[model samples]
Target: MKIATYNVNGVNGRLPVLLRWLDESAPDVVCLQELKAPQDKFPEEAIRNAGYNAIWHGQKSWNGVAILARGTDTEIKEVRRELPGDETDEHSRYLEAVVNGVLIGCLYLPNGNPAPGPKFDYKLSWFERLITHAAKLYTLDIPVVLTGDYNVMPTEQDVYKPERWLDDALFRPETRAAFQKLVAQGWTDALRKLYPDETIYTFWDYFRNAYGRNAGLRIDHFLLNPKLVGRLTTAGVDRHVRGWEKTSDHAPVWIQLKEK
Candidate 1:
């Protein structure tokens, strides 16, 4: 089965681009982030017309997440609208489901740019909650695939100009350490595990013509639990999609798994 993740930026504005990618890629399951729409404005009819069943958590104009399963409705195992420490409903960042018996989660982690403030603090606290939740899943002994725009550059190699991002929250020592802690708990960075030396990137900035110059970062990822690592047959970034007209800053990152 093929599982992919794409941050469409806005569901309504990028509907055409999304439909085109779906037709071409045909992933069995797709996790989406940054819908930037309300629940009522999700364009459910259009998505269903494209041959997929979707469950989405949407907000007005900021963060949102969704999962789309082709050919059938996915079994939603859980929807974590609020993180454990998040008392205020700040963002629609996480959603999880079970498709074809594989546990999948879609996330849009906080940007936390302008660090050393409340937002940055929230980001770290959010990571802590995510680690707690991930620990619970690790104990389940099931194949879990977590995919999305992590807003994190795991290492120096994952970014094109590492120096530019060193002071940024995404690549800060604290951020990378938090991400490493999660990986140490037994999650495999799917694409990196497959092509360790290849600079496969899934996101490029619209400013400075980053996509044209191939100045990008592999922040979007698909991290699989150890139980799912053995099933990972192939994983890659579909960078061509970023060249499409009115495309998102992010391209699709996908993985194919061996049949059970």
Candidate 2:
């Protein structure tokens, strides 16, 4: 089965582009982030017509997420709509579901810009909460694939120019450390494992002709559990999609697994 994740940026505005990709890529399962639309606005009709079943958590004008299974009969066991540990938190950044016996944790981790500020603090606090919850998932013993736009560049190799982004939130040492700790809990980063020495990237900014210059970052990820790791046969980023007209700043990252 081929599983993928895409940060669509804005689902409504980019529905056509998304539909085009869905038809072309034909992934078995997909996790989407940054819908930036309200609950009533998720383009369900278009997706269903394209032969996928979807469950989404939507928020107005900002964060939103969803999971899509490529066939009508695919079983989708709803897991959780929001990440726990914060009662007042209402961003639609996390969503989980069980598809074809695999637990899919789709997350858009906090960006946390402007270092030493409230947003940065919130990002760290959120990371700790994710750690606690992710630990519990490790005990489930079932196959789990945590996939999405993580918003952090795990290493200097993940970005185009290490020095240029040294102090930025995404490449900052503290942010990367949090991601490392998550991996330390036993999740396998599929793309990194598959392309260790390569400068793989999943996102390219529009400014400074980033995409044309091949300036990008690998923030989107697919972290698999030990069980799923055994089935990881292929991993890649659809970088060309980023160059499409009116495309998201991010690209789709995917993995193909051996049958369960």
Candidate 3:
């Protein structure tokens, strides 16, 4: 089955581009981030018409996450809406579901810009929570896929110019270390595993002709638990999608798995 993740930026404003991608890519399972809409504002009917059954956690004009399963035969069930370890945290950034027997975790990690501030502190705190929760998921011994816009460049290879972004929140030493801690829990970075030497990027900023210059960052990622790693067949980014008119800065990233 083909599984994909995309940060739509704003589900409403980019509805057309999203619909077109859904039709063209036809992934069996899709994890969406940055809906930038309230729960009630989600375009359920439009998504339904596009042949997907979805469950979403939305926030007002900010972070949001969703999981979509294509077709009727897929058994989709919501398992969790928020990450454990934080009751006070109300960000609609994490959502989990079981899609055709595989556990899928879709998340939109905090941007945490302007480091050494409260927002950066919150980003680290959130990372800690995710790391703790991910450990629990690791022990489940089931096929699991944790995919989304991670918002961090895990390594220098993930960024267009490592030196330029060294102090940026997304490429900071603390941020990268946190990501490594999560992956050290025995989750495989699918894209990196498949193409270790290649410079792959999933997001490109709108300014400075970033997309045109191919100046991008591989912040969006797919992590597979031990049980799911063996099933990984292929992975890639739909880079062209980022160039579409009124499209998101992020392109779609995907992985295909062998049938059970």
Candidate 4:
């Protein structure tokens, strides 16, 4: 089975580009973030016409997530729309489902920009909650994948210029530690496992021709549980997708697993 994740930026505005990628890649399952559309505004019919069934949680004009299972034959059994442990938090950033016999958790983790502020604090607190919840999922002992734009560059190698990002929320020491601790809970970062030394990036800022200069960061990820890691045949970022006209700043990051 091929599982992929992408931060679509805006599902409606980029529907054509997204549909094009779906037709070309044909991943068995996909985790999508940043729909930037309301629940009623989601282009469900368009996505359906492309031969995929989807479960989505939409918020107005910002933060949204979804999981898509390719083809009509697969039943997208939704597990939840919100991450546990945050009753007051209402961002539509997480969506979990069972697709093609695998448990997939799709998320758009907080970007936490403008460090040393309330947003940054919220980001850290959110990370802790995710860690706690992820621990519970790890104990399930099933084939599971947590895939999305985590928005954190977990290491120096994950960014194009480590020094420039030191003070940024996504590259702060604490942020990286939280991400590393999550991985320590038996979830393998699949892409890094496959290309340990390569400088792989899934996102590029639109400013200053960053994509053109290859200035990017590996913020998007596929974190697989031990059960799924054993089946990880290959993993990669569809970097060329970023170069497409009207594409999301994020390209698709994916992994192919052997069927159980």
Candidate 5:
């Protein structure tokens, strides 16, 4: 089965481009982030007409996530409205489902810029909860895939201008350490493991015409559980999608796996 993760930026604004990509790519499963639309505003009928069954957790104009599975209604195992210990109900960052018996999670991690502040603290706290949840998932002994715009460049090589991001939240030592802890818990960073030496990327900044310059970052990813590692056959960025008119800053990252 082929699974793809895309940060659509905004569902309404990018509907045309998204529909076109869906038709062309034909991925069996898709996890979308940054819908930027309210729950009532989601175009459920349109997505269903396109042969996808979707379950979305939406909020107004900022953060949202959804899972779309071709020809079948997704079995949403959980809708994490609140990260543990987070009383503010701040962001709609995570949603998880079971598709074809594989536990999948889609997340839109906070872009906690201006570090050494409340936002950065929230990012770290959120990561801590993710670690706790992931540890429990590991105990379940089921195939799992976590995919999304992680908002963190796991390594210097994953970004085009590494030095530029050295001081940014995405590349900070603490952030990387948090991400590394998750990987150490037996989740495989699929793209990195598959093409270790390749400088492939999935997101580009709109300013500076980053896409035109091929300046991008591989912040979007699919982290698979150990059980699914050997089944990973193809992993890549659909960079062409970034060139579409009115496209999202991030491109789709996809993986093809051997049948379960």
Candidate 6:
């Protein structure tokens, strides 16, 4: 099965680009982030017409997440819609579902800018919550794919110019360490696992002709638990999608699993 993740930035604004990619790529399962729309505003019918069923967690003009399964025959049994350990935290940032026997967790982690502030602190707190929850998922002994826009460059290789982003929240030492802690729980970074030394990137800013200059960041990721690691056959980024008109800053990233 082909599973993919993309941060669409705004589902409504980027509908055309998304549909085009869906038609072209035809991934069996997709996890979308940054819908930036309220629950009532999600374009359910449009998505259905494109041959996919979706369950989404949306918020007003901000964070949101969704999981899509192609075709009516595909089962998308929802497990949860929010990360555990935070009752008052209302961000629509995490969504989980069981698709074709694999537990898929889609998330849009906080973009904690202006480090050393409330937002940054919230980012770290959120990371801790994620870490706690991920550890539990690790022990489930079922095939699991935790994929999304993590919003952090886990290593210097993930950022175009690592030194310039060291002070930034996404690349700060604390953020990277948190990501490493999560990975240390025996989750494999799918893309990195496939191309251990390649400079792969999944996101590029609109400013300063970043995309043209290839100044990109590999923030979006797919983490496969031990049970699913052997099935990881191939993975890649659809970088051309990022150049589409009115497209999202993030390109679609995907991994194909060999059928057992």
Off by over 4 Å in 4: none
TM-score per candidate: 0.96, 0.98, 0.98, 0.98, 0.96, 0.99
lDDT (Cα, tens digit) per residue for candidate 5, span 1-260: 89999999999899998899999999989999999998899988889889899988888877999899988564545545444556776677888888887888888888888896888888888888888888877777778888898898999889997998887889999999999998999889999888999999899999998999999988998889887888899888889999999999999889999997
Q: Would you list the C-alpha lDDT of every candidate in the order shown?
A: 0.87, 0.91, 0.93, 0.91, 0.87, 0.95
Tens digits of per-residue lDDT, candidate 3, 1-260, equal 99999999999999999999999999999999999999999998999999998899999877999898998445679999999888999999999999988999998999998997888998999999999999999999789989999999998888887899987999989999999999999999999999999999999999999999999999999999999999999999999999999999999999999988
Which segments of model 5 are wrong by more than 4 Å? 72-82, 85-87
Write model 2 residue lDDT over 1-260, tens digit each, in one string: 99999999999999989999999999999999999989998999999999999999998766999999999778889989988999999888899999999999999888899876888888888888888889989878899988898889999899998899987888888999999999999998999898899999999998999999999999998888888999999989888899899999999989999997
Give per-candidate clash totals.
0, 0, 0, 0, 0, 0
* Candidate 1, lDDT over the whole model: 0.87
Superior by lDDT: candidate 5 or candidate 6: 6
Q: Candidate 5, after superposition: displacement of residue 105 in Å?
A: 0.9
Candidate RMSDs in Å, in order, are: 1.3, 0.8, 0.8, 0.8, 1.5, 0.7
As a whole number from 0 to 100, the lDDT of residue 124 in candidate 6 is 97
Q: Give the Cα error of residue 4 in candidate 2, in Å.
A: 0.4
* Best by the lDDT measure: 6
Show the lowest summed lDDT stretch of 10 residues, model 1.
74-83
lDDT of 1 by residue, 154-226 (tens): 9988999899888899999998999999888988999888999988788999999899899999889888887
